[model samples]
Target: MTNVSRWAAMLALLFATAAWGGLFHAGKLVLNNVDPFWFTVVRYTGASLLLCGILMLQGKVRWELLREHWRRLASLGLMGYGMFGILVFIGLSYSVPSHGAVIMATMPITTLLMRWVFERQRPQLWAWCVVALAIFGVSLVSGVWRSSTGAGHSTAFGDLIAFVGTVGWIMYTRGQASVSKLSVIEYTTFTAILALPGLFAFAVVATLLGYANRPDPADLIAAIPPILYIVVVGTVLAALAFNKGVRTLGAVHGIVFINLVPVSALLISAAKGSVPNGSEMIGTLLIIVALSIQARKMGLGAKAAK
Candidate 1:
């Protein structure tokens, strides 16, 4: 690929990251008006349809691949979409968002370990350094350096659940390593589609069990704008860009960009009238430097992989 194409792909991933960041606000809005489980069901359903439309437009839909790999695709859907969502949601109840946020900020390091255990790929000294800086940056941004009182919350349990959720996401990223026959679009769409039944089943069960805070139809209707933005921009667009970046940049390198999430969320939050702070600024710069190193090497790595 030309340098131009590489840059374009990087920008696309950045946009996808930004979309995900926007989801922080969007999710907050929807939670006020809809059941979290119900919201996730709608979000995934919409994402699947949006992806199907995109694949059709690009003439890149690969439904036959599903016939050959339904099991793996469904498993990926369970890892990437299911466990992360369910576990993280439950975890937030037991712990503060700060705790979950810190754990999530460690995604690159977690994914690095997944790469080692699953792919048997050992990262070099530089890779380790990058991940270390990334963790420090994420810690700073996520307020890991700040002290907190337990305030009667089970932060330990919550943090552990969040860690497990992080593992689920790491596995999802690892899914890309072996599924080379499918295009990024095909992989994202099929997995998302196949995962729907399971997600739907969970939502239905929760609703039937009279789960607390379940949203009514009117609440779902009221949350339309944020829901649409989340399903379309956050899930569909972000998934496409992220999968493409992973394909181009390699899983470990591309997954490192998740460090950018806190940065984008902070900036976007600031734009929506939240004040920015010094720690956030420093952390954002740290991520920028770390990702610059990663991207500089990504070009060489991609060329080598080819």
Candidate 2:
């Protein structure tokens, strides 16, 4: 790819990941008023419609692609959009944004292990070291090291659920390669549209089972601003940009950028008057170092390919 194209893709991924960082906080706000089940249903519903509108305006709905890959798209949507969204939000409701962000930062290592297990692709030893550094940095940023201070901002159950959500997202990201014939927007839009019915159905079921409460109309109205941010920025834009970046940079390089999630979360918290502890300050530096190393590696690999 041209340098310009590569840079654009990097920018897109940066924007997407940063927006996702903000999403944890925004989601926390929305979840205060609406439970995870209904919050996901509303977010996905709106995002699907907006994505569909964009697809329609482009005059390329690609019904043939949909018909050709409906099953794959459906499974991806269920796993990524439906399952990931619900579980992450539920985890967010029980935990703080920093915890969610730290869990997300594990994606690079998670992807590495998943590939090794499923595809017999062994990463170089250096790659493991880099990911280990990134994870340690994220742990510091998350104050996981300081959990003994008796802060109740996070819980094991919540972190576990969030980790599962991250894995689902990694699966979704990997699944994108199978549908390489589709454009990023097409993939995101179709998966979201296909996922809506299941999302709404599951939400309804949860409400009926009393696992989640049906959000009142006032609750929806109150959370509209954050919900809109979650849909427009987090779901639609982030999904589109992330897929584009992965397509451009390749998954190994693309996934390393997830380390930015915790950094973004820390910055957001700082902006809100929460001072970063010394560990967080140092951890942020390590995360940036890891990202730089990975980016340089990607550049060298791209040059070699050329």
CA RMSD of all predictions? 3.8, 2.3
Across 1-306, the per-residue lDDT of candidate 1 in tens digits comes to: 678867777887777767766765677677777665777778898888888888899975667889999999999987888888667655555544334444565677676666687679988788788888866765565455655654332256655676688787778878877788999888998889988999888888987888735677899899999998988887888888988887876676667677666666666667777764576567657766776676667668867977
Against the hidden true structure, what lDDT does model 1 obtain? 0.73
Number of clashes in every candidate structure?
0, 0
Per-residue lDDT for 213 in model 2?
93
Question: Ten consecutive residues with minimal summed lDDT in candidate 1?
Answer: 146-155
What is residue 197's positional error in candidate 1, in angstroms?
A: 1.1
lDDT of 2 by residue, 194-256 (tens): 888889899889888989999899999999999989999988999899989999988777877
Best by lDDT: 2
lDDT of each: 0.73, 0.83
lDDT for model 2? 0.83
User: How close is every model to the real structure, measured as TM-score?
Assistant: 0.80, 0.90
